[model samples]
Target: MMKTILLIVTNIEQYASGHLKTGLWLSELTHIYHAAKEKGWKITIASPKGGNTPIDPESLKPLVLDGISKSYYENPVFMNELAQTKSLDMVKNDSFDCIYLAGGHATMYDFPDNTTLQEILRDQYESNKMVAAICHGVGGLLNVRLSDGEYMIKGKAVTGFDWFEETLARRKNEVPFNLEAALKERNVHYRKAFIPMTSNVVVDGSLITGQNPFSSKEMAKVVVSELEKQAFM
Candidate 1:
């Protein structure tokens, strides 16, 4: 059977201050999407609320935009997918082999407290399927609780956009809360790269996470590798 992936992105398009435009980080979705596509897996893009998803302007900057992400940015079909994502309520959680949270600073405002998102994650996780996130996307994992009432990520090794990386990005004070601290408070064995903004990935059984935007490609590689392993087993 072909594996399917459910990608969850935030709907918020700006900062709480309303001065900065922020939404899904383009590379986070592109890297993972292409990785899975290369393996001939199905991909579905969805959001907390079904509608157009905004892109973080900073992600489109020339210095940061990679070839793959840039190509998708210029592709009308791919851009249309972002403009018409399925709402969480419209998705069936049990159908996907994996559920991924794609991050942008906007995710900090929307991903954590979404009840529907939490439910989908809880279902996918409790069912023993893959749950993955990258950068601030890991914020979605903060509030997900299994049936026993434990945070799904509790005691599992994980990583996300670290506080220092926020400082490096010059948004340490702009973000709503400290993501690294939140993950630690949940008691997950959180880890990060020694050098900021570099690739760092953690795999704890079925939960896979990447430390920052730069980690997306490598993280997706790991996700595909693991899923391929599970498919054959």
Candidate 2:
């Protein structure tokens, strides 16, 4: 049987006061989707509420939109899949071999405090399934706790969109809370790139994280590599 992976997208529009930017960063999902497809892995997309994932207008910029991402945006079948994403309530806990959370500013609103998502991550982590997240999607992992009552990311070396990057993006005051500060308060071994908003990917055990949008492709590559290694192990 082919391995299956689940990708979660954000549904909120405005996170704090600025634009929330829903849906997965196009490159984020495309990179992983194509890689997993090459490996014969089936990929499924889901959202908190499901149905009609809205694309971030800024991500559609020519500079940011690559061929794969552009094609994904134009593909009817892919767009339909994104439109009718599976609901978290309907998905079985162990149906997938891995779970990936794609990032966007909108994720800060819905990814955190989602009990259903928390359950999914908890189940995947306990099952030793690959659990990966990129950019703001890492916010989803913020509240997930293992069966033993331990925080999933506690003491784990992780990286996500840092405060400095947020400041540079002019969204520092818009987000619900400072993710880096929240992670640090939880005792997570947080790390970041030397420069603000640079590509930084971290793999601590089965948990993989990427710093920002630039790191999405690399993050997906790392996840696919890890999954391949685990398959042969």
Candidate 3:
């Protein structure tokens, strides 16, 4: 069966600080986008307010923009799709086999407390479907509560951008809240790499996560593998 993936991103363009810009991290989405595309999975991009999604300017820098991201940026169809993402309000949660939250510092602003997004997360998770997020995308999973009123990832082993990484990058002051702290508050078993900026991926059944942009592709591959496993059985 051909699988479908809901690629969710932040609509926020800048941070509260006003000096720094933050939006969707390109590689986080591009890597997973290509990976899923190679597997012939359909993907839909959506945001909370449902319109244009902002790609972080820093992500497009020559130093950061690799061939994959550069090609994605150059694709008019892909750029148009990102610029006009469907609204989350219009999304049917059960329509897709998986939901991938693409990360950026902006995701921290809108992902955690959005009730509608939480509903989608709960729907996908409780249905035994794959739910994955990378980098700041992990913020989306922080507040997802199932019908039983338990945090969706309470006992699940997961990995995301760590406090050490944030502090190392000096973004702790600019971010709205501490991601690692919020994960802990929700009783999540957060994991990270021994060294900052290193890739890390964690797969606990249907719940899959990657620590940073470096791990997004790996996370996507694992998602494909998990989907294949489910299809076989």
How do all models score by TM-score?
0.98, 0.94, 0.96
Candidate 3 worst ten-residue window by lDDT = 213-222
Alpha-carbon runs more than 4 Å astray in model 1: none
Residues 60-83, candidate 3, lDDT per residue (tens digit)? 899778799999999999999998
Give the deviation of candidate 2 from the true structure as CA RMSD. Answer: 1.6
- lDDT for 176 in candidate 3 is 88
lDDT of each: 0.93, 0.84, 0.88
**Alpha-carbon RMSD to native, per candidate:** 0.9, 1.6, 1.1
Off by over 4 Å in 3: none
lDDT (tens digit, per residue) of candidate 1 on 79-170: 99999999999995448999999999999998999999999999998889999999999999999999999999999999999998898899
The order of the candidates by lDDT, greatest first, is 1, 3, 2
Tell how far residue 152 is off in model 2, in angstroms.
0.8
Off by over 4 Å in 2: 16-23
